[model samples]
Target: MPIGKLYGIGVGPGDPELLTVKAARLIDETDIIFAPQSKSGKPSVALNIVQDYVDKRDIPCEIYQPLFPMTEDKEELQRSWDEATDVLYEKLEQGKSAVFVTLGDPTVFSTFSYISSRLQNKGVEVELVPGITSFTACAARAGVQLTEQDDIMVVVPQVSEKLTKILPYVDTVVAMKTSRHLDVLEDCINQDPRQKDIVSVQNCTMDDENIVHGFVDNKKYFSTSIIKFRK
Candidate 1:
């Protein structure tokens, strides 16, 4: 039998409507769906974005939400990856294809990156299906262009002192996962004169979506912020 292939599907940011047509079609055709879950019973944010579509699908598929232990320990993370690989390998070896849903573009700071590399090392074919990114959705909600002519765009997964270090060279800084360092990011933006506009958006396309045209005092874990250095 031919070996089964794997797809790292990006489900887009929190909105079912934002899911790409190809991703939807593949979800219907795939034998199983793997979504990341932080807790045992809780549904994944990525899965939630496409749940409605999954429910309406004519093709039946098994959905597995694997729990990813939250810890900074490298050994723990590796063990988690190994465990995830074992599960995926089981399906692939049986000639069954699986789609792993990710919150944004699978190539961009996704947890699937680690497992995808491992699976590739084990000789499984891997495909990445692109979807609308959170930053793109946030930018649209905030009505700001990521870049203009002669401008540069920089994207960081989280806020840190490194963002301050790069503030002098980049024209725009899009910081995702801002809930961890909102105050620090605000200070960095304040330090740069070129950073003329700052916008923060939470839950970009969902019902509880929030838009802050300027500096924000309230921070949500689901938020992403954009810093525009020029007009």
Candidate 2:
């Protein structure tokens, strides 16, 4: 039997309704669904966003929660990716189509990207269904424009010393996963003499979402900061 196709579906930021029509249709048709959890016992946010669709499927759909730990260690991360790939490959080898749900766009800083690359190398067909990104959702919720005519925007995965070099070249900067690096972000922004406006949003589009005009010492994992420098 030919290997079953694999899908990487982006479930959007936090709202269930934000799932694209294509993503919802695949969720209902797939034989198995895989979602990544940062820890063993914690619920997968991506799975939660699509639970209703999964529950409404006429045929029973299997769900798999693989642990993808949040760490910077390359070796540990590679091991985890390999294990997850093995699990998916076994299912695909049996001709079972699978869907992997991820927060935001699957191609943007998502664990699904790593898994998809491995599966593709193993001859499994891969398809991606794009969804709204968190930073765009945050900007909408906070009523901030990302960019205007001829303006440049840069998206940073983490706030770091490199931001100082980036600030002078872009009209807008979206710093994602800002919870752990708020101090470093503040320092970078302070160094720039240009007048700037900052908006910090936590848990964008979720029920408990918070949007602040200026930076705060936020430690929420889903926090994002949008910095706009005056021209």
Top TM-score: which candidate number?
A: 2
Q: How many clashing residue pairs, candidate 1?
A: 0
Q: Which regions in candidate 2 have their CA more than 4 angstroms from the true location?
A: none
Report every candidate's CA lDDT: 0.86, 0.92
Candidate 1 — what's its lDDT? Answer: 0.86
Mark the regions of model 1 whose C-alpha exceeds 4 Å error after superposition: none
lDDT of 2: 0.92
By summed lDDT, the worst window of 10 consecutive residues in model 1 runs over: 213-222
lDDT of 1 by residue, 25-66 (tens): 998889999998876788788899888878887977888888
lDDT of 1 at 115: 95
Candidate 2, TM-score vs. the true structure?
0.97
1-231: candidate 2 lDDT, tens digit per residue: 999999999999999999999999999999999999999899999999999999899999889999899898999899999999999999999999999999999988888889999999999999999999999999999999999999999899877667677679989999888887877878887888999999999999999999999986857999999999998
